[model samples]
Target: MKKSTLALAVALGAIAQHAGAAGFIEDSKASVSSRTLYFNNDQRDALSANQRSARGVDQRETATGLKFNYQSGFTQGVVGFGIDAQALVGFHLDGGRGHHPNSNSFVPSDTDGSAVSSWSSASANVKARFSKTEAHLGGALAPNLPILIASDGRLLPQTFEGGTITSKEIDNVTFNAGQLEHATGRASSNSTGLAVNGGSKESNQFRFGGADWKVTKDLTLQYYYANLEDYYKQHFLGLVHVYPISEGQSFKTDLRYFDSSSDGKNGQAGYGFNNNGGYAKNANEVDNKTWSAMFTYALGGSAFMVGHQRVNDDGGFVWMNQGSVVNGNGGSEGAGGSSFYLFTDSMINSFVRAGENTTFGQYSYDFAALGVPGLKTSIAYLHGDNIKASNGSGDQSEWERDMRIDYTVQQGVLKGFGTTLRHGAYRGSGTGIHDQDQTRLIFNYTYSFL
Candidate 1:
């Protein structure tokens, strides 16, 4: 593609030379969201028993996201400049793949594979800020912290066209950095110049750094670093706390940490770049690090929890899950199924780490003291054990259980509407895929203009 757009125009001229235009954007805002999806799967060991005879079913999906923003405020002093725009659309109101639907990517495919419905993308960005910090170049659409994580799980939620930065000056501390070249996948519609799974060695590169600390007010701390250039190198740590043992009750603690290994040409020389092919070698590279702890307690409507995690080595502790949504909505930030890695992230499965030390616990509830104001609920369970490479190998184990319900609209007339329902089930014997059941439904809508 013309040398990947001349290497993304020389990497956006070095992120537009440190961007400086002044509080970029003075006004303008628009938003739209719509999604309805259902998908199912059952791999059956992926063929060769006469190519098996099963795959998956259930399908119905849709997507839409449109955003517009423009901010301008700094041109008079320090350094300010701004501009932002976004547009995305998709459609596939029904099922395809004859129903097995290629096993639920919802629907949208066509590189000679079939199943095509609709798609679209339009993006723009330009920014700069001083003091507290802000730097955004162009090609907008990043969902969160690390490198690339913007996944709404079909029907919309995946974007990239790089350059990002943030700072909170001291006080409580919060700093983030970014550098991305290209991406816009999720049954794509256009803007596909960089590839990872299809590999052609097209990448403008990405680098990241992060921090967030709040030593008081219940304590909080998090750290991060990421680089995905040739693909991989990550680190993250987190801590959350809140304790109070009476009236309204309080007791919560969440701790997480991760240190992944390998990068640049998949860690070059010593081999190690099998990503898929049923993996057996490449060692998947090692040097993993994981730690997890969960404790929650509440009384009004009940809340209780427990947690555990470990993965010292033998490969396991990967980050940037394949379904990364944009910067990482993956959560667990500690890099576990909620980690830049997880079980744990339902939707299909991500109990994270295929080899060793993975445990979990949960129970949550919030009915707004019985009045059901914006209701909230949770139920979870997970387990993983010394699961090293198996199938033509040994050492394996797995387990998962989940249930969730969410609601938001605390005021009249559907205020800020948001709703979610999730279900899960998983079982493993020797790990190479097994019985699993999952379902998800989420509704989101936002409006803001001033």
Candidate 2:
């Protein structure tokens, strides 16, 4: 181990030791395991505004990660004492030097077409679980809601510092809360920096609450609220229902709504920051609202889907980027190259904004009936309209088409082998939107050590 790692272990052990280590220290049991992950991405036909072929290597990135998980059972039942832990280490592999340009993931195919030097960081979490729910306090990596969520679309993953609590005492009703502190950027191997969706750099502290209720066996409802330090406050409401028909046909519906406005800090200046260091002057504080609905019908081995969303005013949608601080949470949830808005992933905070409307459509097929058990494919397209920008202009529009494929070994020599691929194309004109194509590939494996 490196000197730094040894020192970290000693520090952690001393802290736990001094805390009386009594009621909370003695857990039921302890066990640890290891994990590994590999990732890659390649962009096609990329160029700068001058139409100058991006002046760099085409595109590609790769990384490897090793993770350690620790779990301690409750100390003595009733309200048992327990703790959960995770430690991660990642190394860059194929991301070339000079490839850090527009490096959404430390990989954009450097100017020299060679990979960058590898880097790593380590983090751990402390948790207490009882009944069906658990609460965690400590710092490792956080996948937060409200203003931001860590973008893990790369080799290893992102982490955050904070505390979170969850409960499922009542069926269909789940409650969650957390106070975040800081975030670790993806390309960076250490916890540092704060930024908002292609916006400016600033501190973000996030607080949120929500519930998911199963009104009936086929219908569900959800509501959520999130406040970001100095940035904005967001609200969300949603409904989902599924109906079955015939032997294997069903219709699924998902509807969502959101509203957002400036919070304490950003409201003061209206200036925003993005990953790279740059600032906008007199950035007008924005207000926005959105509603989106997606419906899917399944018949035989084919499934079709349609979804729509609308933004009401001049706000080009915003969310906490891994580099931002408001909610100070990070993780692999936002990984890869494309719009992160998909499902109503507001497991805590809402990701959509006002002044913009969006529509989503998808089609999928299962090959199991054709003798392929672990193979599945899906294609999706999303469009947005009625966007508002600081220039007091609307009509800023953008759309994306994406395709995904997944496969895993069911049984055989490589029983646990799994693979995934995502292909995407996006374009927009006016209001600071860029055009690009992206491809992401991931390979993961797990081993049992009981």
Candidate 3:
């Protein structure tokens, strides 16, 4: 075993030896979960003569993921201390050299361009708590905030190495702050520094602060500021409100806005900042504004939603990227990809190009209302236009349709077993976008121990 791994084991053993102490074993919890996923993607309509000559993507693969977690209660003291340990393993069940592509969306590929057999990783966090505030220091964190969200679209979820503090000492308000140093991609075990999309230079510092306030029983407001040193700085404002119409019926509204600009080296030459594949009025400087609004109505077991989003003409929506990082001990395949907080973030594409306007809608139903429990389905569609092309072409447009169905066993030995089916189709005209079809089938289950 590696020296690092051995040392980690020794530390964990020491903790286990003290499990009998107060608050150590009495409040401990452990759980294991597994997921099996089948992914397929078919790209249609070649963009050029070379693309026509080359093989279009028509690949399918299957993989399995296992996750184990252990959480220990805080020690007995005015300032309590605890630890959390998590481990992940992924196994590639199918996909050979011919089926594997450079995309590396599902499984990491070997040097010969074949899917890897297996990969695994482990992480731990040391935590402390006082009053209603808590601090954590560790790697393998999955943050779900508007400014930064970890991607979990693949076999494993993306993780970040960082320190974060969250406090709720005040009523109706919550505060959060964090400093992230590195990120591990969903398909690889190695971690790398951060950068914006299409940027090659890695920035090790990403600082953020945010707050969520509940102004009323039915309304909430949020504001956040984030900076990726030498990349970009961003600020976000959000609002959410709900109005009850009747029993089992309500209306909801959500509004979001973002303002961003270049930080340091982004505006300098020799630095990797080009507005991430979009038209930036100020050359490589990050200059963009984006806003979106969504409304939903619910009656009984049915819900309907519609939303619109606008991306400014200066540049495409910007966010962190790790795709260009140099792979260390982990495989190079599937090293970087990301998720943005947008309604247009769909299965096949994110309609975030420069000068884009997107309209989206969705409808969903719960089968429980129809006498069937643990079953639900939804369908959504999005259309985007006025995309600015870098080649001086006219505006481009694209559309996508997605459908999903999920079912879970509610009782018996397989009570926690769950399955989901998702499909999406996309078509575009005038620019880099392509026509594609994608599908995913997922099976999941979990067991808990105390």
Candidate 4:
């Protein structure tokens, strides 16, 4: 059994011995959710011999996942305490040896390059609440912040192992601080230390602190600082504002900026940090600046959004990645790849090359406006240019177009069932990656039992 599960078992035993905690038993909640996913990726461009041998030009996979969650209310006391537990199991539906490339995108591969039949994992956390502040410690954390985001793009969601404290004592202001030691990828059950993309060295310490201030009813400000020890340090600043144009219509503005620099041992020869696959002005040094702004206009069930982003000429935007490490541990098989808090982080690509400038726009509509409730569709396009190359020439560009539709049953036996379809096409010139097309189909449902 995993350490987290064992710890939770002991805590539950202790709670059961003292069965008089009214809140713990009276206000508990439990739920189970299931997701079925179909994924396909088609490589349109030709690849070199080595690339062709390493991965399939066209790949497809299908899988199903079940997730169970339980949340116990805090015990009635001056300082309330509680526990949360989650279990996830995945089963392979289709995807034979030909489809399983050992890429760890949707499922873990065996030694013979075939997808595993099934996998399961469990996690738990203990939490304490005092006034308006709460502290949590455990291995099942999905943090959504400007610097880090847990990916749910695949069959399962990524999770982190760590401790975090959130305080909302001040009116209209919230404070957050956390220390993360390891992460469990969406496809694997084991956990590993943190590292930047392309870096092999893992750092056990990831420290972060942040604050959000609601200056007014329509405006908010955010600032955060994060560091992956021996990898990189980052600072983030964000602003969001919503302006009311009239009834049922509004204009929203979101602006974000990030500044990153090299930490210890990044520029050294054997420490394995080399700007995470982009050209850096200083050899192996982590130096980057990224900024983006998005504006949206909403009226009833229709919304339109446009945004632009710029990556400084020094290096590509850097974030935690654990894909390249192979430590002989179970985590090495399916633990890698992460998501960043950016609109351009799409299904198959991220428009974050060094010296790149990107423009993007999207249009979405809810069918409820037309009397078709629980239906929605959206389309988006992004174009990027001025990517820096390794040979001192900074000429590269890429573009992607994406479309999605989703529907949820509003009534009857399958009232909570949901279906989603997504497709994307990407093309690039002078970029290191290839042009490709990707599609995903998903069905999901949830049941609650208390």
lDDT per residue as tens, model 1, 1-450: 645345445644644553453332334344655555454443344444333322223333343433333333434357655556667666655544434334233444554333556666677666667878988766755647533456656555556766778889888888888776666655555444342331334546667788878989889888888766665677888888898878889998878777766666764443243332122234534345667677778778888877777665344555443332221221111100112333244445454453466677778788888888778888888877666652324366778787879898977776878878877777777666756566666676666654
Evaluated with lDDT, which candidate comes out highest? 4
Pitting candidate 2 against candidate 3, the one with the higher TM-score is 3
| TM-score-best of 3 and 4 | 4
Looking at model 4, how many pairs of residues clash?
A: 0
- The models' CA-based lDDT, in order, is 0.57, 0.57, 0.82, 0.84
Q: How far is candidate 4 from the true structure (C-alpha RMSD, Å)?
A: 2.7
TM-score of 4: 0.94
- lDDT per residue, candidate 3, 372-450, as tens digits? 8999999999998888877534378889999999999999999989999999999988756568888999999989998
Residue 328, candidate 1: alpha-carbon lDDT: 24
What lDDT tens digits, residue by residue, belong to model 2 across residues 1-450?
634345445645644643444555543333332223333222333454333224333444466656565555444445544555666655656534433343345422222333345555556665556887887665664554433455555555567766677889998788777766556655455564344454444554667778878889999888878776666678878788999987889988878776767776664543443211111223545355556678899987789998776655445455555442221222222222212344533111122433456667788998886898889999877766555544445566667778889898999887777788877777665635445566766776765443
TM-score of 3: 0.92
Question: What is the TM-score (0 to 1) of candidate 1?
Answer: 0.31
Model 4, stretches more than 4 Å misplaced?
1-19, 47-55, 274-276, 327-332
Which should have the higher lDDT, number 3 or number 4? 4
User: How should the candidates be ordered by TM-score, best one leading?
Assistant: 4, 3, 2, 1
Q: Taking the tens digit of each residue's C-alpha lDDT, what string does model 4 give over 211-310?
A: 9999999999999999988888999999999999999899999999999999998877655555545678887778899999999999999999999999
lDDT of 1: 0.57
Regions of candidate 1 where Cα sits further than 4 Å from its true position: 1-42, 46-76, 86-103, 106-114, 121-128, 135-140, 143-148, 151-165, 168-349, 352-427, 430-450
User: In angstroms, how far off is 68's CA in candidate 3?
Assistant: 1.1
